[model samples]
Target: MWCRIRRRTALPRKLKTVPTTTAPNSFPCSTAANCGKKVLDYAFQRGLMHPEDMGPMTHWYSPTPRVFLEHFKPEFMVQSSNNYDHPEQQVWDCDDEKNVEHYMELTRAHIKHYGKGELFHMIGLAEWVFGSPEENLATKIRVMKTFIRHLRREYPDAPLLIASWDFMFRWKAPEVRKLLAELDPADTVILDYTTDSGSYSNNFVNWNLPHHFPWIFGIFQAYEPQNDLFFNFDRAEEMYIPVQDDPMCRGMVIWSENSHSNPLLEYLAKRSVDEPFSLGQFCANHCGDRAAAMEGLWEIRINFSIFFRKST
Candidate 1:
């Protein structure tokens, strides 16, 4: 999926939404529009997409929210916590029965409106609990698990793609592990979205260091403010090669705060999975006469990241 943040589609028109399902009430979709799929069968499972669909396509697009919310919009902070934020004190208190039902309503609405998209093939809550200072770990986990169970009961169409960021900074590794272990493995697919740059930790200790679940490989390249351009071509070998060999690796899903700025590198992230990456051949394939210069430019010994700062 060529994910970009805009009202319109991407540049040069690489992606086109091709309707997959012929069934009634199904949404038009592009199963791997630019990348590569389960075609149309929504129940077939395999598809590619980013978590942004939940933002533009899922959460906001639906008319259902307006019905209940009715113009009184509670602000959504970066993290959905019980209590803790600025400019707004709207706590996503799962312990509250009314809050839980309201959450379930919106969640169901999201799936109903965007489920057939295939990229919406999997469901995920991007910003989960943020573990405030007065958090009760056990109670929070219990409430979340129960909520998930309710979702499982209602929508069994696709696997729940859980984000590692959900409990990463807020909890210890062992506690996170326990929460993961208790989840229904058959029903959940973990997206360790920041697999490439473990910069979220003190020193490259990713939230899931020793993963043993149905996990997908990911390279979350950009954040909210965006970053400067610094694409590492060597990742075709260094990053994806090992993933190709790992048994636990289900598939790949690339994440970014923007739609996508670098097509060549983005393609390589997906392309390298099926075959080895050759800078010369890859450059030759795309850059034509400038292949050598392009290859040389990317040969810098830096870790994988392409930061492009948004101007103030």
Candidate 2:
């Protein structure tokens, strides 16, 4: 029974190859999964939040340092304030070279975790400079150049899209536009504003600064895509409803923290055909003070079956 001696078959080793680089798709929004939920859905339907928004990217919804980069997801996200950190509350000055370098390292970590090419439309401070228009213009230009210089060195391939000043355009449009034009051709940046006159007041969304929309409109009309375009949804209820009227409504910048922060959401939930919006204690502007408390006291109560592993 000397069965024909079976020759030991040898398994071949897998070959290792270097990874190839490919450019990112410009229009990454085709399927519903990729597009996720639209802002109108969030407003009108009171829909459930997507996993990515609530997962590791939750930091994008918070107000803190290095958090500015968290909104870099390909889809739309809104934030309350553009304030990076309370630099005023710092024990040691952060503007110093050493401190800036340290923070820059932290900034790199944020970009690594969050997509680097995402656009951020923020409110509160318009005109990248401080002080009067005349003095601030020059200083803002210099600061922008320095900031861009740093970004170029670290993230040469990534783009930094910014809306310089949505509210202060009346005072700082011309110079701001010029500076934006001078930015690297590949850099993504755009200034934005609320087009509706009613945005100035209302319980849900408020745009306190008036008389600046004209200047902002002019810039938007003339803007070329050498940079990015963003829409700040600080008061989304008022902004999104009116934005459908404008032909140039391209990108959305939303910053609603709590359901209460947006009165329109409440209205839509009560009347709309979609999901009901929760009357939660979510203050979009200052959730940092009470985020932990809210999480503990109130249950978001979403399913975690897929995300969890069964214990043996």
Candidate 3:
């Protein structure tokens, strides 16, 4: 049997047929397991890390994610574990008594493992539930409430991040407002996951902004199969400066499905926090006489996404 993991999905075509000793769903085969441990050890020993080193994948609530809390113990981690993302039969049907109980057990275990304080920021795939049968919504909400209860019990300072996908897909203000009613304004946070992708171009999630709702701005330059650079420098500049002055905007996150696929975008995201990022200044310093050509190059990449969208 074989198992393959890639950006939010599966392997690239060329690598799809690759073999694995372990059977299906073995998240960390020997190599992967060791690499994870090694990376964590290195971070612990050197007192160093990457911004992307914060957490595991979006659905990474499995024991696989526990390793990071157990070992990597980074400064921050995003807890994206939930019933919908669980690896079991009751995943999509999380209202089952056993499933509900087990989900809470896992939540408590992780929170205890991390040992109090705000070492983790939580995330949710709200669409994970809403996209499914509406009948099961109550149980899904129960799972969320229980998980948040456990998290807040242990890490009172941390916030539960309601990811943007909830809005990017079928969920909208009414559904979100209903859920928010259960949470404290201070303890609640929003992850606006894809501010730059056309996939979310018309998503009502970002529309009808509730000035009272605090949120983290995000940049999803490119997801898995289309890892090419199609980032928007101009849009980034336009959005970055103004949000800096907004009190409700809590922070920024690199919400890409794959990491390091767009280093310049990542760097600009970080650099702009101190001051507005200037493409001309960056190109003049890094690309020299090729500044104009660099601008033209970005313009080309901006439009490059249309090709990937078509091919896929």
lDDT of 3 by residue, 1-312 (tens): 001121212222333344434446656444664554455456547754321111223343333333223342323221233444333211323334443343344334333322233333444434354334453344445666766666566567765565566465655556556666676778777667566655534432445333556777777665553354455667665555556666788766665556645555545465545754555666676778888898677667767756766687
Q: Tell me the TM-score of each prediction against the true structure.
A: 0.58, 0.36, 0.61
Candidate with best TM-score: 3
Instruction: Assess the local accuracy of residue 211 in candidate 3 as a C-alpha lDDT between 0 and 100.
Output: 59
In candidate 3, the residue pairs with backbone N, CA or C atoms under 3 Å apart (3 or more residues apart, or in different chains) clash, namely none
Choose 1 or 3, whichever is better by TM-score: 3
Cα-lDDT of candidate 1: 0.46
- Model 2 residue 286 lDDT? 32
Candidate achieving the largest lDDT: 3
Write candidate 2's Cα lDDT for 1-312 as tens digits.
Answer: 001100111111211122222237643222322232233234335532211111111121222222222322122122133433343212122234443443344344333332232322222123223455665555445544555566567557654444433334433334544554566544443434333222242211232212212112211212221111111223233344544344333333322223232433343344233343332434333367775655443332211211232221
lDDT of 1 by residue, 1-312 (tens): 433222221211111222222336743333333221222234336553433233212222222222123333433423445333332233344555555555555444433433343332222332335445335456546665756666556666556666655454455666666667687767666666555453334211333433466777666667532232344545424555456556666776666656454643555465645755555776788789998887666554233223322121
Task: Judge candidate 2 against the unseen true structure and give its global Cα lDDT, from 0 to 1.
Answer: 0.32
| Candidate 2 residue pairs in backbone clash | 78-254, 78-255, 79-255, 189-228, 233-253, 258-282
lDDT of 2 at 164: 31
Which prediction has more favorable TM-score, 2 or 3?
Answer: 3
Give the better candidate number (1 or 2) by TM-score: 1
Task: Using lDDT as the measure, name the better of candidate 1 and candidate 2.
Answer: 1
